[model samples]
Target: MNIVVGVTGGIAAYKTVQLVRLLVRDGHDVHVVPTDDALRFVGAPTWEAISRNPVTTSVHDDVAQVRHVALGQAADVVVVAPATANTIAKIAVGLAGDLLGTTLLATRAPVLVAPAMHTEMWQHAATRANIATLRARGVRIVGPDSGRLTGADSGPGRMSEPETIHREVSRMLAAGADLDGTRVVVSAGGTREPIDPVRFIGNRSSGRQGIAIALAAADRGADVTLVAAHVEDAQLDAAHAHPAIRVETAGTAAELGERMRALAGSADVIVMAAAVADYRVADVSDHKLAKEDGAPVLSLVENDDILAGLAGARRDGQTIVGFAAEMPTDHETVLERGIRKRRRKGVDLLAVNEVGWEAGFERAENAVALIGSDDQVVAEATGSKREVADALLDAIVALRSRP
Candidate 1:
C-alpha cells in the first residue's frame, strides 16, 4: 500500500517517527510529508532516513513532478500525526499554504488525524467546531488522549501513542466492504418528549456511538438508513455526507418508532441504538408554564417497546440488535441485565454499557459488552466509540454467517 504520513508542529511529532517506521517495516511504500514547523521537532533527515523516501516541506522541492498533488493522488491512505490545533483549523478550512496542506487538499483517500494540544485548546468551542467539520467530511479522528502533558498540564490533549496510531491505520488499510449488498437501519440519539413548547425531556446521548455505527456500516459498503432523534447538528454532518447513508429525523419516541417501522421491511439488519424515553408526559403544554402559576400536575404514560416490536416482527434471516445503557452497581449486574433484556426483547444480540453522570453519554470513549442469544457474552470492547461500533458490527457479521 502507498501511505502518506503528514507530520505537523507539536512535541508529539517525535512519536510519528515510530509510526513511519512501523509502516515501513510492514513493507508499505511510505512517504513522509512534514510542515516547516514540524521539522523543528523532528528533523527532515530523520523522516527521510526512516521512510527511505525523500522528504520535503515545500511544494517547490519537486515542482516538476507536482509532488504535492501526486503524493496524495497515489496514496491509499493519508495519516496526520500530532495534528495540532493550528493544523486542524487549517485543514478544516482548506488552507494550502504548506506542502502538507496541499497534499491533504489533493487527496481522495481516507484521512486519519491524531490530535495533540493543551486541554484548554482541545475543549475550546472553536476547536470542537473544527473537529466537527473534519468529521463531517468523513475524516477519522483518533485521540488526544487524557494523560500527562508537557510541564504540569494534562487532559485530553496528548496525541495517541505511535503504536495506537499504527494499529488504526492498519485497520483502515485492511478494511474491506464486508457489509456489501446489505441493507441496515440504525436509530441514534436520545428522543425528545415534549412537555411544553419551550421544553422537553431528553437524555444526554450525543449520538456519537450510533453515528459511528452508521458510518462503520456504510464504510463496509452497506446501504444505511440513519434514523436520528435529537442528535446534535455537528454530529449529523457525517451521516448526511455519506453517500451510502440516508438521514431521517424524528423528535419523540413515537416518531422514532414510526420511522423505524417504515424502514424495517427493507433492512437486513436493524440496530436500536437510540435512547428512547420509557415514558412521556401524557398532555403536552401548549404554552410555557409561568412561575406564578405554581407547579402543575403531570401525568406520565408508558411508551411502546420499539425494539421488541422490531424483533418480534423480524423476517427470516433478518438480524435485530438492541442497545442497553444501564447504571449498574457492578459489571456482573450489567451483564445480567443485558441477558435478560436480550431474551425479553427477542433480540439476537444486546450491547450493554454502564452509564452515569460521568461514565457514558456525550463522551468520546465507551465500553460495551455484546450479549448473544445463548445468554453468553460474545464480545467485550472498551475504547473509542468507533472501536465499539466495529466490535458490535463484527458480532453482527458473525451472527449472520451462522449456518
Candidate 2:
C-alpha cells in the first residue's frame, strides 16, 4: 500500500511520527508530507528517517518530476493527522498553495482527516461548517478527541493516538469487505467497581480482545459501537478515533449493563467480551480507607448479568455472543463449561477460553471455542487477538446467514 501521511501545524504533529513508523513497519510505502509549520515540531529529517522516504513541504522542491501530482496519483490512501482548523478550511475551499494541499487536490483516493486544535477553534461555527462541507464531499473524518489539551485546560481537542490513525487508514484501504451496513455493539475491558474515591476493584483485562473485535468490525464496514470499561488511554483513543466506530465508557458493571441494553435494540449483533465483575462493593466508602485505621471487612453484592439479560431480551434476528473466561480443571471442562453457559444464557454463541494468572487476561494471544446453543462446538480460533477477532466475525457472518 502507498500511503501519504500529511502533517499540519499543531502540537499534535509530534504524534504523527509514530503513525508514519507504524505504516512503514507494516510494509506500506509511506511518504511524509508536512506543512512548513509542522516541521517546527517534528523536523523533516525525522520524517525522512522514519518513513525512509524523502520528506517535503513545497511543490517547488520537485517541480521537474511533478512529484506532487505523481505522489497523489500513485497513493492508495492519504491521511492528514493533526489537521488544524486552518488546514481543514484550506482543503475545504480547495486551496492548493502548498505541496500537501496540491497533493490532496490531485488525489482521487480516499482521504482521512484527523483534526486537532483547541476546543474553541474546533467548535467555532466556521470550523464546523468547513467540516460539514468536507464530509458532504465524502472526506472521512477521524477525530479530535475530548481530553487534556496543550496546557492545563482540557476538552474536546486532543489528537487521536497513532495506533488509531493507522487503524483507520487500514480500514480505508480495505474498503468494501464483509459486514457492510451491519450494526455491531461490542463491550470491552474489565469493569472497575469503586470502593472509595481513590480505590476500586478491577481486573487484568486490558480490553485487547474487545478492541480487536471492534476494529475488525469497523474494517469490515460495520457500524460499530464500542462500550468500553476501564480500558487504557491509548486503546480508548483508538476505539473512539475510528470513523466507523462510536465509543462509550462505563466504570462499573451496572453502567456497562445500561449501555449494552440501550445499544442492543438497534444492533444486529452484540458481543459481550468485557470481563465484568461478578460482584461489587455493597457499601462503597465515601473516603479512601487507610491502613492505620485497622482491617476493614468488605461486603459484596452480585452484579446484573448483562449478557444473559441481552440474550433473554433479544429481538428477532439479533445475534448475541458471550465470552466465558474460565479457570477449569481440564481441557474437556473448558468446552463443557462453555456449552453449559451458552445453553444457560440462551445466547446464540459463547466464546469459551481458559484464563488464569498468565493465560487470557492482559495477554496478546488467546484461544477460544465458539460453542453453539445446542452444546455443539461450532468453531475454534487461536492466534493474536486481531486474528481471533476475524475468525469470530467469520463465524458470526456464517451464523447470521442461517434460517
Candidate 3:
C-alpha cells in the first residue's frame, strides 16, 4: 500500500515522525508531504530520515515531475496527521494551491484526517463547518482526544496517538471503502409524536449509539445514510460535522415511515435505532391547549412500527437490526424484553439494554445483550458507545453470514 502522510503545523508535528516510521515499518510505501509551516516545527531532516525519501514543502521542488499529481495518483490512502484548523479550513473551502492540499484534491483514494487544535478553535462555528464539509466528502476523522494540548489548555484538541492513527490508517487501506458502491440506510434518535405545536411525546434517546454505528460502518467501508430525528444537541453537532453521511430529520413515526419506505427497495442494511412513539395524538390540535383539565383529555392512536415494517417490507437480502431501551429490573427482565422484541419485530437481531439507571440512554457508557431470532446470545460486549457499536456490528455481520 502507498500512503501519503500529510503533516501540518501543530505541536503534533513531532508525532507525525513516529507515525511515518510505523507505516514504513509495516511495509507500506510511505511518502511524506509536510506544509511549509510544519517544516518549522519539525524539519525535513527528520521526515526524510523516517521516510527515506526526499521531502518537499512545495510543488516547486519537482516542477517537471509534478509531484502532487503523481503522489495523489499512486496513493492507496492519504492521512493528514495533526490537521490544524488552518489546513482544515483551507481544505474545506477547496483551496488547493499548497502541495498537500493540491495532492489531496487530486486523489481518488480515501483521505483520513486526525485533527489537533485549541479547544476554542475546535468548537468554532467555521471550524465546525469545515470539519463537516470534509466528513461529507467521505474523509475519515480520527481524533483530537481530551488531554493537554499546546500552551496551558487541555480538552479534545490533542491529536490521537501515532499508534492509534496508524491502526486507523491501516484499517482504511483494508476497508477498500465502498462509498457510492453499496447502499445502507440507518435511522437514529427518538421520534417526537406531536400533541400540540409547542410540545410532544419523546424518549430519552441521545443518538450517540446511532452516530457510533454510522461512523463504524464508514470505517468498515460502506455507503451509509443516517435518518436522524429529534437528535440531541451534541449528536446533531457531530452529525453535522460528518461530511460523509446524508442526514434526514423527522418529527413523527409517520414521517420516518415514509422515508424508510422510499429507500426500502435498494438498501443493503437497515438499522432501526430510533425510539419511535408507540402512540400519537389522534387529533393533533392546531394550537397548544391551555393548561386546564384532568387526564390532559388526550386521545391516542397507534403509531406504525417502523422496525417491523422495514423487516417485512424490505427487499430480499436487506438485513434489519432493531434496538430497544428496555427499563428492566433483573437479568430475566432483560432477557425477556430482548427475546420478545427480537421475535415480535421479526428483526435479524435486537440490541437490548436497560436505561433507567444509566445503563444505556444519555450516558457515556452502556452495556447490551445481542439477541438473535433463535433466542441465543450470539455475542455480548460492554463499554463505551464505540465498543458496544463494534459488538453490535459484529453480531450483525455474523447473523448475515449464517445460512
Candidate 4:
C-alpha cells in the first residue's frame, strides 16, 4: 500500500511521528510530507528515518519530478495527522500553496484527516464549516479527542492515538461495500446489572468483537449505530471518532434492551453482540452495600430477551443476528448448544463461540460459527476479532441475498 502521511503545524505534530512508524511497520510504502511549521515540532530527519523516505515540505523541491502531484497520484491513501486549522482551511478551499496541499489536490484516493488544535479553535464556526465542506467531498475525519492539550487546556482537539488512526486507515484501504445503503444496529460490551451504586454484576466482555463488527459494517458503507455498555475509554473514543458510526451508551441490560428495541425497527440488520446479563438484581439499592453487613440474600429477575424480541418482531426483510457465548464440555457440545439456541431464539443467524476462562471474553482473538435458522453452520471464522467480524458480515450479506 502506498500511504502518504501528512504532518501539519501543531503541537500534536509530535504524535504523527508514531503514526508514520506504525504505517511503515505495517509494510506500507509510506511517504512523509510535512508542512514547514510541522518541521518545527518534528524535524525532517525524524520523518525520513522513520518512513525510510526523503522528507520534504516544499512544492519547489524536486520540481522536475513534480513530486507534489506525483506523491498524491501514487498514494493509495493519504492521512493528515494533527491537521492544523490553517491546513484544514487551505484544503477546504482547494489551495495548493504547499506540497501537502498540492498532493491533496492531485489525488483522488481516500483522504483521512486527524485534527488537533485548541478546543476553541476546533469549535470555531469557520473550522466547523471547513470540516463540513471536507466531509461533503467524502473526506474522512478521525478525531480531535477531548483531553488535555498543549499545556493545561482540555476538551475536544487532542489527536487520537496512533493505533486508532492506523486501524481507520487500514479500513479505508480494504475494498468492500456490500452493506452500502444498509442501516445496521449493533449492541456491544457486557451490560452491568447494578446491585448498588458502586457494585454491579458484569461479564468480562471487552466489547472488542462487537465494536469490530460495528466498524466492519461501517467499513462496508452501512450507517451504523453502536450501542455500547461497559466499554473501555479508548474503545468508546474510537467509536465516536468513526465518521459512519453513531454511538449510544447503555449501562444496564434493561437500558441496552430499550436502546436495541428503539433502533431495531429502522435497521436493516440488527446484531445483538452484547453480553447482556440474563438476570439482574430485583431491588437495586440506592446506597452502597456495606461489607460489614456480611452476605445478604438478594432477589434476581430475568432480564428481557432482546434478541428473541427483535427476531419475533422483525419486518419481513429485516435480518436479526444473535450471539451465544457457551462453555460446553466438549467440541460436539459447542455445535449442539449453538443449534439449540438458533432454534429457540428464532433469529435469522446466530454466532456461537465456546467461551471459557481462557478462550473468549476480553481476548484479542476469537473463533465462532455462524449458524443459520435451519440448524446448519453457514460459516466458521477464527482469527482476530476484526477478521471474524468481516467473516460474519460476509455471511450476513449472503443470507440477506437469499429469497
Candidate 5:
C-alpha cells in the first residue's frame, strides 16, 4: 500500500519521521509531503532519507510530474500527523495552495489528520466547528490527547503518538477485507433513570469495559462501533482511524434500548456490556422534586430488557453476548450462577463477573468468565479490561467456528 505522510508545523511534527519509518518497515510504500512550515521543524533531507522517496513541499515543484497530483493518485492513505490549527482550518475550508492541501483536494483516498495544538486552540469553537465539518465529509481525525503539551500544559490538544496514527490508517485500509467486514456493536456504561429533570437513578459503571472491547476488536481487525452510555468518554486508539473509535452516547435505559435494537439486523455480534437500570420512575417531573415534599412516593416500572429482546428478536446469523455482574462467590458458585444467567438471557454467550464492593462495574481491572450454550464455562480471564476483551473475543471466534 502507498501511504503519504503529511507533516505540519507543530512540536510533534518530528514524530512523523518515525511514523514514516514504521510504515516503510511494515512494507508500505511511504511518500513524505511536508508543509513549508513543517520543513522548519524537520529538514527535507531527513524526510527524503527516511522515506527513500523525494520529499516535496509544493504543488508547483515538478510541472512534468505534477507532484501534488501524483502523490494523491498513488496513495492508498494520506495522513497528516501533527496537523496544526492552521492546517486543520485550511483543509476544513477547502484551500489547496500547499502540497498537502492540494493532495487532499485532488485525491479521494482516505485522509487521516492527527491534530496537535494548545488546548485553547483545539477547544476553540472555530476548531471544534472545523473538525465537525471534516467528520461530516467522512474525513478521519485522530487525536489531541489530554496529556503533556508543548510545555507545562497538558489537558487536551496533544498529538496522538505516531504508532497509533499508523495503526488507524492500516485498519481503515484493511477494513472490508479484514474480519470479512463483520459489523459489531458494543454497549458500555451504566444507564440513568430520571427521577425528575434534575434527579436520576444511575450506577457506577465507568465504561472501561466497553472501550476495552472496542479497542480489542479493532486490534483483531474487526469493525467496531461503541454505544457508550453514561460516564466520561475515553481517548480513542488513533491507528484504527482518528478519533479512532466511533461513539454514540445515551443516558437512559429507554434511550440506549432504542439505540441497540435499531442496530440488531446489521450487526454480526452485539456485546451487551452496559449496566442498565432495572426500574424507572413512571411519572418523572420536569422540575426537581422538592426535598421539602418529605420523600414523595416514587413508583417504579421495569425498563425494557435490551439483551433479552435482541436474543429473542435477532435476525438470522446474528450473535449476541450479554454481561451479568454478580456478588462475590467461589468458583463453583460463579460457574453455576453464570450458566443459569446465560440460559435466562437467551443469548449465545453470557459473560459473568463478580461485582459488589470489590468486583466489576467502573473498575479498571476485572476477572470474568464466559458462559456459552449448554451452560458451559467456555473461557475465563482476569486482568485489564483489554485482556478480558481479548478472551471474550476469542471465545466468540471459537463459538463461530463450531457447527
Candidate 6:
C-alpha cells in the first residue's frame, strides 16, 4: 500500500515519527510530506532516513514529476498527524498554499487526520465547526485524546499515540467488502413525541453510533436502508452521500416503527439503534399551552415496543439486532439488563451501553458489549463510535457465517 503521512507544525510532531516507522515496518511505501513549520520540529533528514523516501515540503520540488499530485494519486490512504488548528482550517476549506494542501486536494483516497492543539483551541467554536465540516465530507478523524500537553496543561488536545493512529490506518486499509450482496436496515437518532406546536419530548441522541453502523455496513458493500429520527442534517451528511445507503426520516416512535416495518421484510439484518421513548403524552395540544393554563393535568401512555414487534414479524433467516441504553440499577449490571432485554425483544443480538447524565448520549466515543442469542457476551468494545460499530458488525458477520 502507498501511504502519505502529512506532518503538520505542532509539538506532537515528534510522535508522528513513530507512526511513519510503523507504516514502513508493515511494508507500506511511505512518503512523508511535512509543512515548513513541521520541519522545524522534526528535520527532513530524519524523515528521509526513516521513510527511505526522499522527503520534500515544496510543490516546487520535483515539479517535473508533478510530485505534489502524483503522491496523492498513488496513495491508498493519507494520514495527517499532529494536525494543528491552522492545518485543519486549511483542509476544511480546501486551501492549497503548500505541498501538503495540494496533495490532500488531489487525493481521492480516504483522508485521516489526528488533531493536536491546546485545550482552548480544540474547544473553540471555529475548530469545532471545521471538524464538523470535515466529518460531513467523509474525512476520518482519529483523536486529540485527553491527556497532558506540551505545557502544564492536561486535556483533550494531545494527539493520539502513534500506535493508535497506525492501527486505525491499518484497519482502513484492510477494510473489505465482505458484506457485499447483503441487505441491512438500521434505525438511528432519538424519536420525538410532540407536546404542542412549540415544544416536544426528545433525547440527547446525536445518532453518531447508529450512523457509524450504517456507514460501516455501506463501506463493507452492503445495501443499507437508514431510518433516521430527529438527526441533524450535519449528522446525516455522510450517510446521505453513501451510494449504498438509502436514508428515510421519521419524527416519532410510531412513525419510526412504521418505517422500519415497511423496510424490515427485505433486509438480511435489522438493527434497531434508535432511542425510542417508552411513553408519550396521551394528549397533544394543537396550540402552545398558555401560561395561565399552565400545569394542566397530563397523562402518559406506554409506547409500542418497536424492536420486539420487528423481531416477532421477522422473515426467515433474517437477523434482528437491538440496542439497550441502560442506566444499570444497584442490583443489576449493564450486562444483566442487556441480556434480559435481548430475550424480551427476541433479538438475535443486543448491543448494551450504560448511559447517564455525562456518559453515552451525544458523544463522539462509545463503549458497547455485544450480547448474542446464546445469552453470552460475544464481544466487548470501547472506542470511537466507528470502532465499536465495526466490532459489532464483526460479530454479526461471524454469526451469519456459522452453519
lDDT of 5: 0.81
Instruction: Supply candidate 4's per-residue lDDT for 263.
Output: 94
What's the lDDT for candidate 3?
Answer: 0.82
Model 3 ranges off by over 4 Å = 6-22, 25-27, 33-43, 49-53, 56-168, 176-180, 215-221, 232-244, 292-295, 330-336, 357-359, 363-369, 376-391, 398-403
lDDT (CA) per prediction: 0.91, 0.88, 0.82, 0.89, 0.81, 0.91
Q: Model 6 over residues 125-203: C-alpha lDDT tens digits?
A: 9999898777655578898899999989999999999999999999888764668889999999999998888878889
Q: Write the per-residue lDDT of candidate 1 for residues 199-254, one digit (tens) a residue.
A: 88888998889999998898777999999998989889878988899999999999
By lDDT: ranked, best first: 6, 1, 4, 2, 3, 5
lDDT of 4 by residue, 86-150 (tens): 99999999999989999999886668999999999999999998987776445778987999999
lDDT digits (tens) for residues 1-403 of candidate 2: 8999999999999899999989999999999999999999899999999999999899999789898788898888899998999999999999988999999988766689999999999999999989877764446788889999998879998999899989989876765256889999999999999988998899989998999889878867799999989898876775776788998899999999999999998999999999999999999999889999889888999999899999999999999999999877745687787887888889998999999887998766789999886788888998768667877888898899898
lDDT of 3 by residue, 23-112 (tens): 999998899999999999999999999998888978788988889688988888999998999999998888888789889988867788
Score every model by TM-score: 0.74, 0.60, 0.66, 0.62, 0.56, 0.74
**Count of clashing pairs, candidate 2:** 0
Off by over 4 Å in 4: 1-175, 330-332
Worst 10 residues of 6 by lDDT: 132-141
lDDT of 2: 0.88
Question: Which 10 consecutive residues of model 5 have the lowest summed lDDT?
Answer: 235-244
